[model samples]
Target: MGRFLLAIGAPPDRASDMWKRFEESGAMRLAVELEGVQLWSSVDLPLSIEPGGSRMILGQVRSRSLGDDDHPSGILPQHEQWPSWPKLIEAFWGPWLGIEYKHRSLRLELVRSADIEMPCYYALAAGGIYAASDADLLVAAGACTGEIDRAALASALVYPAHRPSSTVLAGITELEPGRRLEWTPGRLRGHALWNPWDFALPPAQIHDLQIAAETVRDAVLIAVRGCSAGQRVILGMSGGLDSSIVAAALRATGAQWSGVTTVSAEPAGDERYYARCVAEHLQVQLAEVPDNIERIDLRQCHAAHLPRPNSRSFSQSADKSMLEIAAASGAKAYLHGGGGDNVFAMLDSVRPVLDRALDTSGWAASQTVCDIARMTGRSVVDVALRAGRLALRHGRDAPRIGNSAFLSQSVLETAEFPHHPWLDTPPGARPGKVLHVNWLIGIQNFLEGHAGQGDLPYRAPLMAQPVIEACLRVPTWMWCTGGRNRAVARLAFEAMLPAQIMTRSAKGTPTSFLYDILEAKRDEAREMLLEGNLASLGCLDRDKVEAALGAVQRLMSGDVLALMRLIDTESWIRARIARQRD
Candidate 1:
């Protein structure tokens, strides 16, 4: 959540000069290099060292560690700067960007937490690589060319979750979640810090519901407490199991926190009843902000400054309200249950049934079929028959997120590629787990940066690395226990949440809100897209897009969502064009 710039694999002079180059812009004031390590960061206590220094440790990271109020801002305690300090962060866990460097050697390693998404980018510069947590800084420092990357933009438009490394900015690479890069002069090595496949396909999978529940509970608490330390947190609560569970953790942490829920005028978008129940149960003050679409600036494009257009038109109202609440109340962070569904294996498919049959014996498998049948409203025979068919004949059956019909076939045939490295698992891998991992891939863009929320750090604790790992280890079938999706998670917070929230089957959606936005901004969106880069760049088909927008009233909810995504992307593209013209 801190803005930083670093020079890796550069000669000493060039590496040392980066501080002067970026900082002289008055953007990065003071907080310069760590003497031996050339990292200049805005985070005061950004580095952590274990007391024993025995093995490279992740728990020792001050900001990410639990119950540590002393350096809650994390790691900067004015200790003597070590020459090897940067290198020690090689295996650094959690949602931080760590760069390992040797003082004068060509040896350098850059690592970041896969727990939550932070915008980090690196561009190969003259004789070295210049990296930064903010893409603008890299572009300003001449590390990035400042030119837009239309090819990457094409992939993002068709499928936003297309790839991890490629960013909307061309020539710049995003250090993806749970991944690391090691540079050794001639060759650069990069690999995943953690793999969901390992958790899904293994004897390591958590089969016991009790154990899985306990593990999830612990991980959630750690993720919450670590981020909540020394900070007043404003939680985005939706009376849903995920946010309610987060509320429970906030209660346990004894931190200064409050729950804020956005009330939608549309019935489908409203979840106040559940939010109120949880707040009353937790005995916390709840602030309900009504979603006001009239308040949204149709002409304003939030992704104007972002590396990509990731923000939605809906959040323009909700996030504005939350930003005001957090600012007025002196809160330093925002927490939400954004990725709970995916992390908890909330799938609509029969993969859970298939997964259950794979590991369980006759009675357990039979019970699972019944449970899945009840959850999905399918007959037991149908569930069993489907599971049998999937198990018997499959190369890799993990469902993939397909491109929308609005996209051009040329873009589909030519630009299509494997969206994520983790998506392609080894042969015989469980499609259920692959499907679960796919959920994680799809939700990556939801990890919004602090910049969008008035500089207050945004925390998605449920999506944190430890919590993700714990849930990934959980057997896919375990989520459907007692015929409930995410039953393990429900079990984890059974005591803290209200009974109604624990058992509620329905969840809110912005389908109506999407329709509302389209109706309200239909003309604006039409002019924007018809004249924007998406159609001109050959990313989306013009006639199809025109039909989706022109017939907004008659279009389905999914089509509306798709159109909104294109508008947001087109808005970003137009903003970039205007900036260049300026």
Candidate 2:
């Protein structure tokens, strides 16, 4: 990936002057200001830049493209100068420049995709406007002083699905997903660039199974067309519907493919037999990794990737390692069945409301909020009541993404904030709508941000804008008309995928390796927790942390959710310390 930085508000004539400013501060090169936009480019890793005299620091990083046969170097070329500001802006945004500009005051011209591939962070202080692509670099520019925000920490501890806008530290606000913040002079405005409510399922859009199949096929083709022609694409096939369909999609595109199945020696995690069947059916090479949880190095892992105390012990280190393995094995791009669950409308189970007096008008066909609360030991009644209230408020006949259990507690708490002062609804009214909102948020904020930092390009064919738009137009009954899950997308994909893949039901959850991995590293896990590497940060509950780790040491099987939370907490704590040092 390449890094580009721009500092506006500085005098255009000070080319050499800006150069020295950057050089003295170890910034890669001199800064250039043109047409009210100053810019700099760097190919170095661990990118760092000094504060400029201007209030704007716009950084654009181009990650390795999935397909770039035209560019022999496997990198997207950066034109030294654009013909006009609009062209340069379009280059950064791709297809997003057409969206309405609500937060225009930030005076910053932002044009990233709905999925945030290249993330930008800004902090207004006495020092002027400060922005950076990396959180560490933003801190280095004196934007945030390595402090954690307590509310953000609480949200993280409570929900593992998404990250909130405000971090653990007070003053440092994160740009939420699907949100664009523009700050200029005395005003700052952040607007939701996308809302699932804006997109509706069209009535009787696709009854013809053939039409659905072709649509799915077309979506898959469009998703992979940008990949490097011969790059081996990696699929996380689990013999489940999502990955299986994806595998079939790759085969249809004539793309060379390989599959990785994380198998447990026991029956529980081993989807290998089914996975093998699907792989063979699709004629793709597959590899199996026996992830023995009993012998994993949990403590060492904690020491390396996680330093905070963890109540969850075992984890499959294989998932992390497999990416590098796949890359080394000649795969330049990886595609997974991520976003399949949301697309498929795979409501886990429906709960019958006890309140016979209440009309179903206030609720979606699926009781998502209630189901979620039940699964997580939360108050189901309260969640359901909120959903009912939301349906009544929006006056929209359709079930929105914001009305689900996962959205209110997991997705929104983790990824978004309590903004959007424009509307009024029950606390839980927009359960489905919130999730749809986060779909945009995840694309515009999280996915791209993470990928950019890691120097890898990530694409989700399932979450492609066109695919989402089509699925939204589909009727709920048509969604698996034959009683199949993910009916809409599955039906859409029928022509592109094998019948075996299109009809699969069982799915794999990554948490299956949770307990096994923790047990293997029990001792190391205890040491890391007791050592208090992360306790120095006042934002955590040390007593609770110790107890959690101790409980995890006693587990034999797996608790995937707890395990993920442990890793997330530890990583966050460590990142806080590292950022503080910066």
Candidate 3:
């Protein structure tokens, strides 16, 4: 919810010059430069910053926080916590450092937790290394070459949305989620901590659903206990299982809560009935904001609040509408049902996992392989063998077939590469044996993607670490549909939820307004796609670009997805260009 920028290599005397670039940008909150590695935090809060040799560090200490006196960790011990930050820096930097700190005993270079919880960016350049919280701030520091990366462009154009940290700009790599990088002279060191092996199952244990659900409910309640008393907590009620579960958890916590929904007013997309059911179940008040763009003047607001690349799910008009509701709601934090799909369903990335899960005969495995082969435009049996090889390479015991093409890729990438400290598995464990591990991967991916973005403190009780750890330990019959087929979440929700809410389907599906944006503004959308400053950004495949846009035009009028894909691509490209110009 806050942005901070730190730049090393400036002379102690001219530190003010470096601070000016980030502080004056309006995007940052408080920008400070200090001598001997400054540690700055509210005196009452346990959080702080300090110096370790040449690098700076930041972190928080567990103590009673000032915001909520009832909270056990009341306030951070600033000076003491400062030393702990350097210990974190060392984790990212590895060895080769003489340590220094603002606080002597705490040792910022060598003490404390691994959760740095700070949004930071860094780049290695000829002069030295530069670090900041925002990508734009990095550009302003003169460390960036101002050239867009073509690979990122290809990813955005071909994939659904631009993945986090992987922007459409060239030579500019984001520190991947859960990872950090350090620079010293001619070297750069990096490390990621979100390992799935951390949550690996014991040799003879299986999780129980009833007990696991209660444990999940408890963790969510514990999180709610930290909320400031007398504050109204907001839930982004989508009438879906994830959000409903979160709302129920808040109710169970006995906290003051409210529900908010952004209804597109396009047919049945309005979540009033399900949201009301949730509210009534919790006995809480509900507020509904129709997705009406004309009611709020987007043009004026965009200029006033967002003069750069502002990407919204729908048109700028819908963006303005949502902002208005948030402002009016007086809610500081919102709970979301965001990660249910990744954890519950096989999702779009099932094929790879399926290829690894099946125990079919050589002939059947060959057929499965052929299916994958044909999908990728290769020979059937040959592709089947290739699929088996890929499964073996990824350490899957059996391969599942007929899963979603996109999600299958996710499983392949995630299974192949370890992202968390806990994701480490035995060398020969088959893919089918690691369903719980895959669930953890999906959870990590969700947190890194959604919770890390925008202005909301989007909480996911269902994806809570303990929830997923427990889910993985339970039977696969409760989570996957086709051994990887479909509707795993739907079945589980039905068992736990009220019948009306349980039977309801559809979540976050953009309604008719999305198609309306295209139908009413096709010319405008085309102009932005073809003639806007974004088109000339030079990193995207011009042919793929044209093909996607042309496809958008020929698609059915109600295909909100196609329209969104087109607009998101355009917006991403436009934002990159705008950032470059800035």
Top lDDT hit:
1
Instruction: Please list the residue runs of candidate 1 whose C-alpha ends up more than 4 Å from where it truly belongs after superposition.
Output: 9-25, 30-38, 43-73, 76-93, 395-397, 449-451, 579-582
Q: In terms of TM-score, which candidate is strongest?
A: 1
> What TM-score does structure 3 among the candidates reach?
0.67
- Report the error of model 3 at residue 90, Å: 18
User: lDDT (0-100) at residue 371 of candidate 2?
Assistant: 42
- lDDT to native, each model: 0.72, 0.47, 0.44
Instruction: Give stretches of model 3 more than 4 Å off.
Output: 11-14, 22-46, 49-118, 160-167, 180-182, 200-205, 223-231, 293-310, 315-322, 345-475, 480-497, 503-508, 533-563
Error of 2 at 11 (Å): 12
**Cα lDDT tens digits for candidate 1, 288-317:** 998887877655676565677776666788
- Model 2 over residues 432-452: C-alpha lDDT tens digits? 333333333333222232211
Q: Which structure is stronger by lDDT: 1 or 3?
A: 1
Q: What ranking of all candidate models by TM-score puts the best one first? A: 1, 3, 2
